[model samples]
Target: MNSKSRVVVWSTGGVGSIAIDAIRHRPDLELVGVWVHSADKVGRDAGELAGGTALGIAATDDAEALIGLRPDCVVYAASGPERDAGAVPDYLRLLGEGINVVSTSSTSLVYPPSYFHPEWRKQLESAAEAGGASFYASGVFPGFGSDQLALLLATQSKTIRTLTVREIALNDHYPVADVMMDGMGFGRPLEFEPMLSTPGFIEMAWSAPIQLIAKALGAQVLQIRGSLDRRVTDRDLEVAFGTIAAGTCGAVCTRAAGVVDGREAIVVEHIIRMARDVAPDWKTSDSDATYQVDIDGDPDIHCSLTLGDAEGHGAGRGAMAATAMRVVNAVPYVVDAAPGLLSSLDLPITLPRNVLE
Candidate 1:
């Protein structure tokens, strides 16, 4: 425990890049290696890929090769399939090789004791037990404000009748633009699937967090539903970043519901859009960017969070990294966690006033 831990980063996407930056800033962690899925980035320096100067860590696509480096811990920023079906298995493989893990994949991994793949949890637990390693996961708005915020509000309630969580975000970008287009009902020639499975869609990303809050509040999820709509540019519309067709307005709506003792006690909503303000019916100001969270209980509570300038939107990147860093730093605690799925509520955690500060 006295020695600095050697760590490997498993991807170089936005989350991965931010994670590498956060890792480099940590004195206790040594970023000895990085893994990228692209062949083009194989020989590049991790620092360069992360928008920093050369840090001597090379990016390689060889997952098995990085595994051979025998890092004490691996910070996985890889997403998608890895998050859904491969997270626990990948953790198990690394644990089997005596490597601990912290990831930004499972956003709601931090709350409610049961918000995970049960079988996967068992696999990770068995592997960790056999190899004496640890695994943890968290990130961004999904990781923090939703799960953590809801859980925090639950503490003020005595006889909680119902819980509602809503998340809104604008001015966000992702590497996967096609997924974004499809999810937003944009680039696609036709609207096919809901936003549930598309990348960069908050609805898809918010599911676990909603589940986390529900489980923490002891609500049994009855059903989950989602929807999406977009406004296509009639003509090419020009913006600061680039020109978009008059159409290109991306929007999504999602909801998850749960029942407590046959009463609908929990509902979560996520809304993502690219408009000046929410429509009049949704009841949002026609002003600058903002965020809001309203918690209704026996006492009836309400909270609103707003972010205005570039700095406000930029805060999300740092927020994402900070969530991962905080969760990663708790690897030792994760190592001692009981078998099976776990959450922030399952552990003794003092959420720092500002995750990165």
Candidate 2:
């Protein structure tokens, strides 16, 4: 709605690259500038990083320079340690400059701020208010998969007693390395911290999801519980993506339970691991990957949902790009949204018309 119709991309990593490919193919959205933290990538063509023909959008390490341009929006895909620290400043700068933003920086931030760093959340809120813009964080799994699944289940009946969502992903090697290597309990034994302590890693990163579903059901959440379990191996082996390096075989399961008005009404579970020739469990291990969701309500009513096969990133680059694409695509609508700490629940689920296939 700014009429500028230009969008900037920050970073060009796994998710960032995907977002670039998605943006490059769109006619309505212009790829104006690219921000890179690594000095090596600066001055490089953004199109090359995205595996496309050069588009003349050179990468720069300067955020202030990009902010000065005042693009309509920025799609943030930057992550890692820098995300919590340096990324915040960039976000604030863009917001303070009155540029609308949509990002996957902290995918779950679009939800409630209870589980997140309070200081960071407040900073974002302040930036948005000062600049008269909107911000949202989104991703493929939590933003839509488990969180939305629960919300959809709650709608089937008026006497819903309990809600449960279970996801089985035996092909997500990237997340395993991410959680094990960079996650809180990596070097230390799992017993030391437990899954509950690292809900930010294992379970959905956003606390707003539980709160959102509870509110939608006309109830207030009283408590939340989480647990994590990992399947270990002694020898390294190569899987679909790459080598597992022995010692890290099997799966990681994270479970979160939410109590509404002193009663357990929500249970969210996620399982990510390497599944090759055989299923981890004897009963089900015939396929490379399988995703399913089960929601139970009063009278044992259950809705079984399953996602069809998706190679590599599970929906591939398109699905990965969709996470950021949908967010940036929603900038125009979000700018017109009511101010305050907004929730993904507050945004529309449909993709905008301008985005491409």
Candidate 3:
């Protein structure tokens, strides 16, 4: 019998927990270790922590201990707000140790060579070459649902003019306080500058998708521009994270556009709200949280994707699952790839294993 691929799940948060569940259930993969950041989760069973039955594996906060196990691949699902200083080194260390990586921690790394700083890119490239390991970064939005899926749909078009991808989500159901409240400034004063509004923040965050789409279409992006706007709530609202009182920031609309030859050729927009009613004037999905792609071409195509459990996991949790699964499903392809940084454009079509069974 062929041996299963040894894997370790790094972190167990919104996305990491889902990755743990995926690794544990896959027949072709073996869950060897789990890395945690919190002291409270250090000794807990990986399965139990991931909202599933107990698995034999235990979680640990010690990064060195997990690295010592020398797993074939590491599924990196750590959160990425204000973590660049530490996260980049961690990725380099893992790659330098000859362990391949499939990660959702850094969206910018989705197409690093095109958008990331040259110094950081050089470090990662040298590490992967020296260790003979590969690194691939992805997530639901910057990964498949936006870039890859849009490119696939474009293949059917007779002519192409412009493409726009939008992510409309109800943040009330999203549980991450650091991301929803702090990073997004969801409940802050209207005048406050959330992390997303910082200069170049939107361009950096959404550059991967814009670049990916622009490259796929053989278009050179001459410039990238971004915009951010927000709305205040009229009433106090309770959410999974906390409470958003009246007269506070309750919704955010942001967009990054890629310009080619003095025209906006590709764009990625995010319309997120603490409640459905907060952004009633803005476009929304048919479901609570939706990803929509619109193509303005000869055929003029529009695609919408909604992932959530109508009966079980809510839209927020379901979106997290989709993000985690996108990384998990790419593990095999990443593992077999040549040693270096990889983008969705370079990878083969990846599908979930044993999803039907």
List the pairs of residues colliding in candidate 1.
Answer: 110-344, 232-246, 232-247, 233-245, 233-246, 233-247, 233-248, 234-246, 235-246
Query: Model 1: per-residue lDDT, tens digit, 1-357?
Result: 424667788888776787688667766667889988789999999999988889987899887989988887787777773365756567678887778777777665554244445666566678877877666666545655666766777788776666776666554343355546544454333345545545434433445766677767666665454444444434553333344445445444555555556765666665654443423345353223334556665677776555444555554454555655665665545545654335666556633222366
For model 2, what is the C-alpha lDDT against the true structure? 0.64
Least accurate 10 contiguous residues by lDDT in model 3 = 308-317
Q: Candidate 1: minimum summed lDDT over ten consecutive residues — where?
A: 278-287
TM-score, structure 3 vs. true: 0.93
Ranked by lDDT, the better of candidates 1 and 3 is 3
The model with the greater TM-score, 1 or 2, is 2
lDDT of 2 by residue, 52-165 (tens): 889888999888889877787788888875465756787787888888777777655757455467888888889888988777766655666556656665566767777766
2 or 3, which is superior by TM-score? 3
25-100 in candidate 3: lDDT tens per residue?
8997889999988899989999999999999888998888888998889999887556556688988999999999
Number of the candidate with higher TM-score, 1 or 3: 3
User: Best candidate per lDDT, number?
Assistant: 3
Question: Order of candidates by TM-score, top first?
Answer: 3, 2, 1
Point out where model 1 deviates above 4 Å.
1-3, 80-89, 108-122, 187-207, 222-249, 278-280, 283-291, 306-319, 335-341, 350-357
